[model samples]
Each structure stands twice: as C-alpha cells, then as structure tokens.
Target: MKLAELAKELKIPTESFIKFIQDFDLELSECISTNFEVKDDFAKFARENIVFLRKYSEDLNQNKSIEDIAENIDQPKDKVAEIIKKDKPKLFDNGKYKSSVSSFGIDNKLGGNYKFVYNYFGKNTHLAERDFIGYRDLFFFVSQTLEPYLSNISVQDWGIHRPAGIVLYGPPGSGKIFWAKKIAEIIDYEFKEIKKYFLGISFVDDQKITFNDFLIQIMKSEKTLLFLEDFDEIMSERSEDESVKSDDEETKEIILHYISHFEKENILMVGAANSLEKIDRELLAPGRFDVLIPVFPPNMKERSEMLFHHMTEDLSPDALLIKILEDNKAHQLPFWLEISKKMQAFSNTMLIDFTQSLKKRIRNLYLKNNSTTIKITQKMLDASLRDASSKLTGTYLDQIQQFIYDVSLNNYEDFTVRIEALKVEVEHYKIVDEPTKPIGFTHNDEIKQKK
Candidate 1:
C-alpha cells in the first residue's frame, strides 16, 4: 500500500504527485511550530487525493470481489484483475480477494501500527517551500539527491551509489526534527520514530528486543523511513560483550547477529543531533549513515517572517487590540527586521518564545481585567526583542561563531559533499576588518583612547 501505488491507481502522474507533495504546509503537532499555507487550488487537490486514498483503503478489503474493487475505484474489472494478477495473489474460490496490495495478512502483525503501512510520517510531505524560510538551497539539495534513490530511476545504472542514510545536524531549535519528518514525507515512505526512551537504565535484553522488533517491521515493508533520534546514544548501548555487562549472551548475540550486519535495501534512515562530533565515526561509513545535511538558523528575512507569523496568529482581536496590532505592524516591520539582523545566532525557538512571551502578557492582561484598556505598546515588543537577542548571541557571539567555524574547518572531511562545500565557504569567510568586540561593550582600543 505504497503512495506510489495509490497514485497509480488514481491515474496521477509522477510529476503531478511530486507537485502535490511539494504544496503541503502542515501545522506542527506542537505549538512551538506553525504551518503557513498554500494556494486554494493546491489545497483542494491534496484533499481530493486524500479522499481517494481513504476510500480505497476502506473499500478494497478481502471481502470484496474483483468487480466490487473495480466499481469502488471506478476502474474496469479487467484492469483490477491485471493488478491482482501481477501481484500473483492467492485466488479464493468465489472470485473474492485474498491478499495483494490492499491486504496485510502476510505480515506477523506484532507491529500493529505497521498495519496501516502505506504511508509513514504522513505529515512530512505537507510542506510548502516558504515554510522553511531560509532553507531553500538545502531543501533543494536534499530533494534532488534523494529523488533518484527513492524512485527506481537510478537503480538501473547507479545502484551502487544509493544513499544508505541521511543525518541533520545543527544547533538546537533549528527545526532538525521538522526537516527530518518532511524528508520522509516527501519520499512517501512509511515513517517510524524511535527515541532514547531507555536512557540511564540497564535492562539491556528487553531494550535490544524492542529495537529489533522495529527493524523487523522495517524489513517487512516495501519502503520504510526509520528515524532514530539520538542515534549516537542508541549505538553507545551496544556492548562488545553483553554477558560481562548485562549477563545476557542472548543480547550479545542480538547485536552481533542483527544490529551489526544490518544491510537492507529500499530503507532510508535519518538521524538528528545537536553535536555530531561526539558520534562514533564507524557508524558514519559511506554504506551506513553517511550524508550530513546542515540545518542552520534563519536569516534576517526569515527571522522577520517568523516574527510576523508568530505575532499574527489565530486570534479574534477586539477593535482596540486590532488597532494596536495595526500600529505595531505599520510602524515596526522595518525596525523588527533591522533588529532581527542584529540578533545573528538566535534560533527559531528563541524567536517563537519571544513572541509567546508577548502573547502571555496579552493573555494575562485580558484575564486580569484590572485596567479598562489593554493597550499594547511597541516598547514592550522592543524589550522582548532585546532580551531574546541577549539570550542567544549575547557577549559571546564571536565565541559561538569561532566554535562553529573551527568545527567546520576541522571536520569538513566527515560531511557529505553538499554540506562540505557549505563548510568550506563558512571557513573562508573573511574576518580581517570586523571588530571582535561584543555589541554595546567597549572595545580595547576605545578603552585605551579613554585612558
């Protein structure tokens, strides 16, 4: 029950499906993130696609005959028979369906979540280009590189060069998790998430079995997206000798047999981390989890957009409040955009939190009802912007910059080609004329002149 199969049944061409996927702007399940929007026509198209999918899954079960499926999908019986015959399905006596694209009777069923296995990480695909703001180039790089690998296009001549894995690395709150999900979604693969739930515990055997069950489910699918959050920590749990550490040779056997020798086709794995420097290099081998895609902080324009987006949310504003917001908008867009440029290292989370702080103040004022007018001023937003600025870049912006620069210069060899080129460009940034002093602080030369 792959998305590609669904597309074929609906007579949606590959190009149309690609366009369909690229038009989505999903609202994040968490409040910290937001989903902007797409055009009305695009939204209608996506909805129509989803409607067909739901109906197909619901009506094309084993109880239905070939004629029934044909009627349900609005296709001729001969075409339905052709699809079934190609599957080489087990024939029932009464011309009823037994098992094929729509059936899951072959799977062991321990992975009940895997039963609805057609599309995984379903929300990832619903991302519009503008949603990522400053990540257009990196987004294109990922999509273009992954296009051939996921589809059977490159398999004919370039099978040896298939991407085994992809990793997203950046500072915290830079939307690594969001990007990872989007990648899986765009590929139309089933996305299964695994977290470091068993951290700081010692039930090695149980944890190993649980992890294996996930892999077993992956092996059971046509194409699967396995998201291993904190992958470095997960790998660290493996013991060279499990018996000596946890008194279970079975756990040891599991690692040697199942984990180490894991080489699967048509399965793409993605990992996200704040600092990949601590990760073991062995796991990053070319045939393993190799590609590294950098997810950096938003640029000035993106930050400004983020600020605007968070400020203008799903609120039914009163007349007074609306006026205040209007004034805030008319007078403050340029000022906020300028301030955002100065807040260099600030992340998406920081900007969102600052906006949320403003929201909280507004909420409290409405709830308190102490004052007749809930008048909001630009000064309050100015203060929050300044505070968020200080919280991230602060007096050590140079230090953070240098740290990132040093890491990139040193580990450029470890990164994927696209990321390595970006790293090289970062390493080459000319720092000669720029003053290293923190903003609002006295420089050494200025102090000497004052003396």
Candidate 2:
C-alpha cells in the first residue's frame, strides 16, 4: 500500500508516515511514486495491512501475480502483495514490535522470545544463587514446582520458557531486595531495575501508559528480569474520599495483566513490597503471582549462624554471649559486628565493663526499633544485668516471666522484683568466683570459662 494509506490506517498523520519512511533511511524516487501502475488513491488501506506486508514480504512474494498490482493499488490483496515485494518497506524491521533498547543501550531480542530485565540501582551488587539468604530454599522450591508446568507445553506449540515472576512481601529490612538480586543472578536473567518514582511518572495525568505497553517491552526481550520495588506505595489503596486518588485500581489492572500474560508467555516479572497487608488482594491472588514468598527476619538458628559468621575472626565471645546474642531479637549480625569492634578498642580492665555493656547496648538498640535518638541509661542496664544474673538460679525462669510481664506493661513492682532477683544472682556468682583471680592480674577473665 502507499505510505499515505498505511499512515492513515495507523492513525498517524501523513507527514509523520513520510517522516517514518525517511527514518527508515529509504529514498523513494519521484518517478516511482508518480508512475505507480494502480490508479486508486491507496490511502485507505489499514495500518495492519502495511504491517503484514512489511513483515511477511518473503512469504507474500510466493503468491503475487503481476497483473494484480498493475491493476489497482487500492485493492487489498494487490496493495498487500505490492508492499510485500518492496526492497525495504516502512514497517519492515522498524515497527513498534521491534524492541528499542532504553537509554542504557542494552540489547533487546524480541523474536528470541526471552525476557529481559535491567537493573540501574543494584549495579554494584553481584548476588549468587547460594548467597540468597532467607529466600534461598523458597527459590529452589518454586523452581522445582514450575518445572512440570513448563514441561507440559506441547512441542507443537511455540511457547517459550521464561523465568517465573515472584512477589517478595514483608516488612522493611526483611531482605526482599537481597533475594531479588540473588534471583537475578541465579537465573542468569538481565536485571531491569525500575525506579518507583519514574514508574509513577510514566503514568502521570491519568495513567497515560497502559500496563500492556510495559509488559510488551519486557516480554519481547530475551533473558530479562523485571524487578519492581516499593510497588505497594506506588499502588497504595485509597478511597475517593481520601486525598490520595486510588491509583490502586489502575495499578492492579496493569499488574493483573502482567501476571496473566507472563505466566503463559514465558516472561518472568518480579515485584516486591514492604507489606503484603497494604497491597491489593487482586494482585496477590493465586493465578497471578503463582507464588507469594514472605521474606521474614532471621530466626534464632539463622541469627546464630549470622553472628558466628560475622564475629568468628576477631572476637572470642563465650557460650553465654553466643546464646544471648541468639536469643535476643536485637542481636543481628550487623549489630554484633559493631559490638565486636567496640570490644576490640577497650583495655583489659575495661573488658569486663565492656562485655557487661554489650547487653545494654543490645537492649538500647532493641528499644530504638521504631525510633531514633533513644539512649540506654544506667537504670535500664542495671535492671537488665540484674535480671540476666538472676536467671542462672532455680527461680530464674519464673522471675524472667514476671519481669517480662511487669516491664512490658509498666508494672513497677514486678519489674523491680525481677531486677532484684537478678542482682542477687550476679552478686552470688561474683563472690563465689572472686578468689580465683589475683587483684593485680590485668588480663583476668571476667566470666568463668567453661572447659
């Protein structure tokens, strides 16, 4: 079909169509344009017609008769055949279906039927499959689970195998980002890191771009992994009454499309959020995500392993310290590493005070969980130290329970009793072991060392 007809059918202006041809680097001669054998205007053919002609020229070449194109350019079959026979048609290798790499200059292989993901923020990270923390087992589980679904695709079908999309949901610092990165590495998929703000902007002024637009771009590229972080805040639920317009509906529709298409089309799309409770339920339903993995905080065993891994080199923490670190919610590897550094700075005489101070530090950190500018005072430390020492005695468990009840609810009496019991236990132990060390022994151990 003539360029004008293709342009009219595409809904683009005639000038734009001419410019598109120019962009394709083709130079059509005036004589060829004026002396076309057909007498029809040729501006009425649909854009899809031109697209078919441009894309399947070789196939069309097999069936075209010479008189068909010479008779009329307006005839659908003749126009299609004539356009197909072109040396280089406007839609050939230049249509929207062809992948255009974004500003990153990355390669996009659309016909390859592989997914592509780009990561801009996590540029420096190199997460391996084995390095994934809490989600390591979950990743493997999903991998095994999806195999049968993939294998069932018939050989006659053109369906391709792409990575499965995952939704990592939980509270902040729950390691979603870590797992996302590791999964990217594990699957050898290109990580396309999307900035949440940019994504919001892309749909500014009434969701200008449909979710299919984004999906088509990602799904067409080979070996791509799309990681959408902080997706909850972007698609937060809000009513019309609230100041926040409900972008949730629009976002959910897009996400639903993404989930539905990716599962069947072999494209892997991953989304992560701080809280699942805050997310739209429609996006979390079974068929869409397929798997919803919660990246929880480190449990006791994991915490112990983390502590040992981070501190085994320089610090010689005792069994009690290890147990305390493992039991305490505040004792993460990063926190313990800081404590180890502090301990390394002090002299022999200060070591006992420092070791004792560690629990207080840990407690203070715990108290600061949901705030900043909080400090650990001598009062809190004394109470905790006393409680710790008392826990060694026969009544320790009972006292601890009472103490926890009292302190948790601000019951001063219960709290005081627990503290006093711990103080007594500490004094008793100190006295019993006092004679073993010399008064001037600068490097004497503080706690009794077990064999």
Give the true-structure RMSD of model 1. Answer: 17.7
What does candidate 2's lDDT look like per residue over 1-451, in tens digits? Answer: 4333343345543333332222232222210131111113223222324553233332223233333332322234444444333322223242311121111111011121112111111122211111322222344334433433323332234344443556765444446676677556544567787664434437655766545566677777876667888766655656574444445456566666566667455566678865544555555566665455544434333433343343222334553334444554333444444333322111122323344554556545656574333443555545533443332332322223333333333323312333343334323323334466432111213333431
lDDT of 1 by residue, 51-148 (tens): 64443344334465767766645566676676565344445788676532342221111122332222422443211223555454456556655655
Where model 2 places Cα greater than 4 Å from the true spot, the runs are: 1-140, 145-165, 202-213, 238-249, 310-451
Query: How many residue-pair clashes does candidate 2 contain?
Result: 16
| Per-model tally of clashing residue pairs | 4, 16
lDDT on C-alpha atoms for all candidate structures: 0.52, 0.41
Most accurate candidate by lDDT: 1
- Model 1 spans > 4 angstroms off: 1-130, 157-161, 198-208, 232-265, 316-323, 330-335, 363-378, 386-403, 406-451
